[model samples]
Structure formats: structure tokens, C-alpha cells
Target: MQAVLRAACRAAADLLFPRNCVHCAGPVETGSYQYLCPACTRALQFCEPPACKTCGYPYFGSVIAPRECPHCAELEPVFDKGKTLFLAKGPGRSLLHALKYHQGFYILKDLTRMLKETPHFKEFLSGAILVPVPLHPTKLRERGFNQSEHLAHTLLQNSDARAVEPLLLRSEFTHSQTHLDRKDRLQNVKNAFALSATANLMNDTYYILVDDVFTTGSTLNACARTLRTAGVTHLRAVAIGHG
Candidate 1:
């Protein structure tokens, strides 16, 4: 009865104030998602097996013989493995843009739903400690909220993760990596992260690093290096999007 009432209330509210699709900016009249309309939701791509173990970008074409993943070929991973929810293009890019740049906390529900439906991603987070790649104090102040931290919390809420820990702290306020090449990116984030005081390194516990996007894997590697130096043994990573 309560569920029916809530549904009816939501229907009435939506009727009064229709939502625009995050990707296409079209009216979201009918869809499984609240933010993404039916067309854009269908455009969203989910990552599956035959993906790169280092960065979780899906492989195209033949899978019998493995080929190098273009995304993380330059990334020397300090963590064990990695996974992502989707390819960061098309609808995926718009979703992240809204969240990271446009102050779209409403997008969290959609992301959480994606995480739940992506079985491998949910399974990867099981029984692990989720570590968000922290923003530097300056960056945090500017952004107002850390998307990585939010993503870590999302993982914790839906998975059997032990907890969300801000174990790695960004010490250096480096410029954005959006335009930096792999070599420049590697240099930019080098030694930019350090372990926080609360980072209780347990050799037995699996620690999964959470980030919003895996563009070059440089930031994630740096965070993993910090944790590894602090004595974390079982380390891996997961990102919401992989470009």
C-alpha cells in the first residue's frame, strides 16, 4: 500500500515537473530510469567480460586471441585488477558531466542502479574496503564534493564492501589531466597521493580503489602505490567509466 502511494506520488510529481534526459535533454516521459530517457538509456553501454583486466575497457571483435587494451597499455598497474561500469562516451559521458561538473547528486541513484545491474562490478566490490581517490583540499573546496568519495559510498551501499575509507589523500594540487598525454599524466600524478593516518593497512583485507573515470589509470596507480607503501597487500580498483 505504501509502495503504491509512493509510486503514485512520484507519478504526480513527474507530471507536474517533467525530467529532461541527462544525455539528450529530451523529455523523460517513459523509461526505466528517472533521469535518462528511454533512448539515452538504451544508448548506455555496460562493460562485460573480454575486457582489459588492467582498466576494464571492453574488447571489440574477436576475443579468442587477446590483444592489447589501448586504454591502459601505458599504465603500470600497482593494483591487482580493475573494473568499470560503462564506456565513457555518448550517454555515459553526459551522466558523468552532470555529476562531476554540474552538481548532479541526483545522478547517484542512476549510477547506483547501474552498479547493481552490472554483476561483475558488484561482485568485484564484495567484502572489500573501498578507498576513494581523495581530492586535495584546494580541489575539494572548489568542487564542493568529491565524486570519487561519492562513488565509493555508492559501492559500499550496494555491495558487501567492508567500508568506505578515505585512505589515500591528494597532497599535491596538480592541474586537471583532461588534456594531458599518458607520459604527462604519469608525471603529473607521480607522488601526488599519500596515505592518510587512518589508513590501517591490513594484509588480509581486499582494498578496492574507487574513481569516477579511468582515462589514463595514472591517478589510480598513484593511489595504489601509496596504499602498497603503507602495507596494503590485497589491492584492486574499480571505476564507474572507462574511456
Candidate 2:
């Protein structure tokens, strides 16, 4: 089965327009299979040094808990810890837009590689189960794919960790978070997620909610709160981009 999947991937690569890096738009000469060239791969940034111990937001210069950027201190994220691979600025933002809006699925491999190479990823993810923040049924149908789930699959494939696609589910439909005020964002996503009754996760299992972007983190917070009600003990969150 693995061999077949690999062959299919290779064939798809051949058919989809041969071997070009998605980031730098340069030709890749030698690599197993990826959409990022060596230069682009080198250019991709991972959050490092002096980040929030609770939420993985980066802090420059000093290694102290940043004054809890207005987003964190006000509401307090439900997840015990959170981390992101990119700062949601520069090329990182552009790449995320392409992956989410344009469905540039090929970047999954590169994103996986980035996550694997991230300095503190495994330490932060230790003993935790991955759960991609789910899309509403309406949105899922419209998009035809959940980018979070796609990223989760890539993470699992490249790392020893495992992930569940729908351990957390959206309980209500809400407006997009774009341009919404912080209070409105929280209210819009309130009571918007719930755990599946069939999920056998114990209170002891550390869960990591997965998503593509972490803006105000209202959505992840809502999801974590639902899991808390369901008896999740130590919770964390992971995302590709952070603002």
C-alpha cells in the first residue's frame, strides 16, 4: 500500500508539472519529493528563542513571558501551550494564503519538513495526541478539503506522532474571523465546538489541537474549552502561522 501511494505521488508529481519549488519557484534538482527548493527551504523561518511558555508566541531580545499580548491576557487561551512554525508575516503569509485559498496541496510535504525540523516541536508535543481543528460541514463542502487535516496528515507521516482528524468538531457555524473585533471574534465562535461522544480519550491524554493559522486564537480556545468539559487534562495547540 505504501509503495502504491509513493508511486502515485511520483506519477502525480510528473503530471502536475514536474518538480518545482513552491516557495522560490525554482527547479529542484535532487530530492525525494517536495515543493520547496534548498534555498527556499533555508529561507523558511521557525519560531525560536524566548517564546511564551504557555502560548508559543515569539518574544524578541529577552527570555521572559511577554506582557501577554492583549489577546492572551484578556481571555486566557484554554490550551495549556501553543506553537506555530511561521510568524504569519512576509512569505509565510503568502504561502499560507496559497495553501488555504488556492489549495496548493503539494506544499504539504514542505510544511511537514518544516515542522519536523522546528527546534522545540517534539519537546512541546511530547506525549500529546494531534487533533486538527475541524471545519464546519458547510465550509468543508465548499472548500472540498480541510487544510488543517491535510497538514496533520503531513505531520503524522513525517513524525512519530499520530493525529485524529475529527476528535474536535464545530458545533455551530460562524462568520469568518477576518477583520472582526476581538470581542466579536470570541462571541462569534463561542460554543462552536464539542468532542465526539465516541472519542475514548482519557482525562490524562495530552491533546494538541491543530490548525492552519493562529490569529487571536479564539477558535482554538473555544475548541479547547469544549475538550476540557469532555475531561481533557493537558492541552496544547499547533498552527502553521501566527500573528
Candidate 3:
């Protein structure tokens, strides 16, 4: 049977290339769908309610109502809204580091699965085009592949979004925003992105910028600004973790 052959192929592949858990790097248990080990799964801090409505940053206050955070309030972001699947800590942090530095391409499958389970994911992506925040040609060459682009492709597999469109192009190669403060982060990415010359952005079309992390949000904001300037009105973002 076709199913039997598929199973046998999977078994052979497993034998040839043993899989490891994305979080713990331990040998994956047979038939386990999640990339994380049981311990790492339990350690993940899923973003919950009372988060910022605009950015989806989780809050731990006793207050019951959800509201915008000061960062969102002070300087309104170009994107309409954003959401992150988990707080960038604990197992989530470790997994992010692996995916960014190491060739953890396999982790995208489990991450997309987790993102599908997030509250409002369907509504968030409805009628939207997935856009991966692009990397400069030099950086892309050095990294081999863009992690954001891979994440966007994984998300598109299950969503009805139009497509994973590389509409935004990085114009300048700036320093990594990793250790930069908020102000410096903003400056580093300023004018760093531009809409592709051949991009055909529809009027009133929604765009969801995809990225790996949402630390200060400067990178996403820059991408959003470029899209907005290109006449994109409905803009938002989604990421794996909220740093």
C-alpha cells in the first residue's frame, strides 16, 4: 500500500538521520509530533490573555482588562497589530537561538503547528498576504537562508493567505539589532527596507510581516513602514517569540 511504503520510507529516513528535539537536542522519541521534548514543552511560556492589543506582549498584572503597552502608545507602530506565540524565555529562547545560529530548519514545522493553535491566528491572517522580513543579499549569503522566509513558508502551508511574497527588499546592510537599545535599533533599521520594484500590492490588501522574534519591533516596523509607503493599508505581523 502507499501508506505502508510511506511509513517504511519514514523509518528508513529516521534510521539514516536520527532526529533531535529542537529545544533540548535530545534524541526525539518515535512518533512524537512535537519538536520539543516533554520537559521543554512544559517549560514553554505560551503568551496568554491581558496582552497588549496591538503588539500581543503578555502582561502579568492583576488587572483584568487588556490594553496597549507604553511602547505601542508612545510611538504608534506602522503595522496595525502583531502577535507572538510565546514569550522569548526559557525553552522558547533556547529554541530561537538554535534556529537562528544553528541550521534548525526542522524546527519550523513544529513552530508553525504551534502558531496555528494560537488564539486569533485564523483571524489575524485572514485576507492577508504573508511577507517575510527580508535580509540583505550579503547577509542572506552568509546565513545560507533567511529564517523569516522559512517561517513564512511554513505558515503558508496551512493558511489561506494569498502567498509568501518577498515584496519587501532590504536595501542596506545594517548592523545586527541584537544588542542595540530601542533608539539605536530604530536608527539601525531606518531606511533599510524598500518595496520591490515589481511588487503588485493590491488596494486595501492586508499584509502580515513574518519574523522570528519581536524584540523592540524595530525591524518589523521598518518593513511595515516601507509597505505602507507603497500603499499597503492593512499591515500586521506575527513572530515565534516576543523578546
Question: Whose TM-score is greatest here?
Answer: 1
Best by lDDT: 1
lDDT of 1 by residue, 65-148 (tens): 888888887787999999988989999999888999999988999887787678888988899999999999998999899999
Off by over 4 Å in 2: 1-43, 64-67
lDDT of 2 by residue, 1-243 (tens): 999999999788777776776666677765633765666656656678467655567776765544665446676878787887777765577578778999988677567667666747756665567898889999999999999988777767766565564787777988788989888999999888888767778666778888888888888889989888888888889888887
Note the Cα lDDT for every prediction shown.
Answer: 0.89, 0.76, 0.81
Question: In terms of TM-score, how similar is model 2 to the real structure?
Answer: 0.82
Model 3 residue 145 CA deviation in Å:
1.1
The residue pairs that clash in candidate 3, if any, are none
Q: Tens-digit lDDT track for model 3 on 200-240?
A: 98886888999989888888889999988888888889887
Ranking by lDDT: 1, 3, 2
The Cα error of candidate 2 at residue 97, in Å, is: 1.9
Error of 3 at 156 (Å): 1.0
What value of lDDT does candidate 1 attain over all alpha carbons?
0.89
Q: What is the lDDT of candidate 3?
A: 0.81
